[model samples]
Target: KREFITDDDSSDVTGAHVSKIESTIMVKTEASSVVLTQQQTSHLNHSQQSITTQQQQQQNVHIKQQPQQHNNIVQQAHPQQ
Candidate 1:
């Protein structure tokens, strides 16, 4: 099993503003599990149009899987809170 979390924050003076966001990701398999986490922050001044700031952080876990002897395989992406 694996677990992940992500947070996003954004602000704009004249446009849409996203105050905060949170997300989590997880992956599990018969052989291994993986997890990922990410965070991002951004600020924009629409009046100036030239001033902008952004920050991002990410964390990931990697699991090595053995070569599959069978040809049957599947992949999927699912959102989980």
Candidate 2:
């Protein structure tokens, strides 16, 4: 059996003095699914330094399984310029 998965997404962040940050991640397989979520907060002395950031992520994965042979998995991610 062989499986392939790909994800491409963009995110926008809005905050003042780094009030809060949150993220979620998910992974799925034929048998089950796994998910994780995390959040963090930051306090800054100067409110004028607050700003928003935008980011984009692209990922590609390839998985292969063989009955009488070895299994193989390949994953790659694109870096921002």
lDDT of 2 by residue, 1-81 (tens): 122222211122234223442222221221111101111111121121123112111111112122212211111221222
| Clash totals for all candidate models | 0, 0
Candidate 2 Cα misplacement greater than 4 A, ranges: 1-23, 28-60, 65-68, 72-81
**27-55: candidate 1 lDDT, tens digit per residue:** 12211121121112111222222232111
- The TM-score of predicted model 2 comes to 0.13
lDDT of 2 at 25: 21
* Residue 43, model 2, lDDT: 18
Q: What is the lDDT of candidate 2?
A: 0.19
